[model samples]
Target: MRYEKIKTLSELKNIIKGLRAKNKRIVFTNGCFELLHAGHASYLQKARAMGDILVVGLNSDSSVRKIKGGPRPVTKEKDRAKVLSLLWCVDFITIFSSTTPFNLLKAVRPDVLVKGGDWKVKDIVGSDLVTSYGGKVKSLPYLKGYSTTGLIKKINLLTPRRCAVRTYAAGKKGNTL
Candidate 1:
């Protein structure tokens, strides 16, 4: 499936309204999605099941760095978006630099909002927005041991941490990270 891109608020708002008119239910999901994993695929697939179209709000590179800290976002935003775009479940992709997807949510006002079960419904950023618009929010259970953080951490384990191995104080004899 081809991926539609949402660049500006106006375009997103129009897209939602247009799709809605065609009796299409849109499902909205947002996250850093730093490193795609089984959990991500499962969550996305479930989100897709909730609506006729799945619009994913991906964090911009800077936003990912800000939320995840430096050395994060193993993949660049473009590459990440491209990867998701190729997925059969994702119909549209929007890259946002905001910490929360509030603005994007308000603009899209999707028929359904989906997130992993780890987050409480009330804790979700756009839950209220969707609810206000008579939309629904659903959470899908995550796959065990499948997470972007866990994936990155596992990769980190394979690659040793860089260190200077400096002598601590003069008499210290233990090496530490």
Candidate 2:
């Protein structure tokens, strides 16, 4: 079934409610998704396989900054959501400004809550709520050697540094020596 991507919380809630009423198996996962990578795609696909509908809670730019620190989320929240929407496995996308997806997860109340293996089952937010209702929580294995932080670090290393320009300037200071 074709799912409309929703940005607002109210719209998402309404859609989720309707889907639930029809007894659709909802699968939920949340992340900053600062950079689109193969790992992300694979993880999302695996999570989607767990249920009929896959709802992705994308962290807003502000939330990314808070969780990932400054100079992070190379892509804005809207752009991140756009990238996620392009994936066939992604059924719905919602940009949440909260640092944690707890509130969003609680509202969705999915039948299955999934996260990457990096996260311990005990650490997954909203696990309690889902499990209390006989829902399942899963932590899928992460793809090795693929991460936003690692990607950023690699890019930084490959790019020429400003210190190289600074070294040239330092040699000409006051025309001494």
Lowest lDDT sum, 10 consecutive residues, model 1, at 158-167
Give per-residue CA lDDT, model 1, range 82-122, as digits (tens). Answer: 88887899988888989888988887888898888898889
lDDT of each: 0.83, 0.87
Misplaced by over 4 Å in model 1 are 1-9, 160-177
Q: What is the C-alpha RMSD, rounded to one decimal, of candidate 2?
A: 6.7
lDDT of 2 by residue, 1-177 (tens): 333575577898899899988989999999988889999999999999998999999999998888889788899887888888889999899999989888898888899999999889988888888899899999999999899999898878864543244333556643322
Per-residue lDDT value at 36 in model 2: 91
Predict model 2's lDDT versus the native. Answer: 0.87
Clashing pairs in 1: none
